[model samples]
Target: MKSTLKDPEPLLETQWPADPVKPRKAGWGGLKRRLAPYGFVSPTVILMFVLMLVPIVMVIGYSFMNNVIMTKHPKFVGLDNYVTILTDSVFHTALANTLAFTFASVAAHIVLGLLFAMLLNSPLLGTRFKALFRAVYVLPWLFTVAIIAVLWRLLLDPNGVINFLLMNAGIIDSKIEWLSSPGTALFAVTFINIWAGYPFYMVSILAGLQGIPKDLYEAATVDGANNFQRFLHVTLPQLKPIIISMAMLDLIWTSQQFALIWMTTGGGPINVTEMLSTYTYKLAFSQYQFSLASAAAVVILLLSMILAFFYIRHQKARD
Candidate 1:
């Protein structure tokens, strides 16, 4: 009889209506959904504009003004800086050296890299030694440019290891001043750069070589192709794209190479090894001609863009 009627509190709780769900503000929700992606991307965009674009724009503007260290207020100079750079024999020499250094280093990189890669990829080599060989070859590249310059400077010194070995080997009767001689300075720097840079090409080309389908080589062999023939007909074609891309990248990197040249040679022996990058630094900091240096930098920027554009066009054409 006591439990026949439910308790009043329990009955009241059961009879109370569930709370209603509030309707979403459809406009605000849709707006947020649309903006979420851009909100995430905004930080990167702002940073690039501030850091990269702003500096480039400022440099370009400064190139047209007399923004030297001596001037409190920069005056507009128009094309005077450009005219001076164009007419300067030193600048011309720098430009030529830059071109020579870039081309020679890249060429050597390709040859040495390809040779090492091919040797490493050969089926004749033991599989156990392949990784070790790659690591050993790549050790030079792991060192900083400054370290490499210092090491090479010592090695190329008149009485250093290189001369000691050469004299002991009966190759030379005298110690050669490799960095102090204009004739040998550029070549020595270029050689050191090539040694440091070839590993990049080796790794790149090795990757490309490994990516080539085994089936292609098998099919070529089935058609009575020898190793050289198969490599000529199949390997070279497959590697062309990778080679072009890597060469272009190397060209850009080599053109901008400064620290090694700066530390090792200082463009010495009458500016024989002065590249555009080193020349620009010498002008800006050492000579304190900021406006002219800006002009030189602009020229370098334009040349780099032009080269990149042509490379892209060539790649697209091949595609």
Candidate 2:
């Protein structure tokens, strides 16, 4: 075996000569790649700073001063404006009304939205019927807030179609001044808001429902669970996270609602429908109390921030 053939040349020793490999230099390409994401988002960052953060900062400064915008030389009173707003009776009334309006709207939105979503997701409905129902239910959402306000004002007029219908149905004997009456203004506006907002929840919930696995429902059925029981144990549990998120968002939005109330009731009839937003608006524009208005606005912002913090914490926990 030793004499059979000359040993093959050692592979390692027979390597061909070549140029030495050079390391890549740090260059514009690497830097560009690193900066690409930030470049893409820079416009949004700039806009938020200018539109949101700057105004917020200016408002906060005004909140601590006296006679801002009204006077050439505004004095820094250091919380006097805040103290004045906090002690005002009208502010208390506005806060209470805001809470009630928000609570009712959000609760009703959840219930109605969930019901409509379940109906839309049902197996019993034909595709055409489901489509028709979806279109009808989402009509309110398609209208702008201004349009909604105008439409509702007409509909809720004492001599309008709603009153006629109610009278015909024997629900009431006399026409109710819904938006004009202090007793009914808050209710009317809250109802209008609820109608406008439910479709958002319905669409979101329907998407969530569609994403749920059929196997879970099937397994529940096999275990002798009925519709109600299955909904209680499976559907509710699956939807818990989405419901919480929507509710929190609704609370923030409903708390800040102003346009509809302003257009419909103008926070009138003894301030029954006055909200934080309307209150601040009147103080700044009508009363020319810019400092006090800024203070009220700052309070609202703090409340919104607290709600946002909870929402973010919830999202992190979910992740």
- TM-score against native, each model: 0.89, 0.92
Give the clashing pairs for model 2.
none
Candidate 2 lDDT score relative to the true structure: 0.94
Cα lDDT of model 1 by residue, 1-319, tens digit: 5678765763444567879999887798899999999999999999999999999999898889986657998899999999988898999999999999999999999989988988899888898798789889989989998889889989999989999999999999999999999889999999999999999999889998999999999999999999999989999999988888889888988999988898999988899999999999999999999999999999999999988997888789988
lDDT of each: 0.91, 0.94
Write the residue-wise lDDT of candidate 2 on 25-119 in tens digits.
97999999999999999999999999999999999999998898889998889989988999999999999999999999999999999999999
Candidate 2's C-alpha runs over 4 A off are: 1-24
Candidate 2 at residue 49, lDDT? Answer: 100
Error of 1 at 173 (Å): 1.2
Least accurate 10 contiguous residues by lDDT in model 2:
6-15
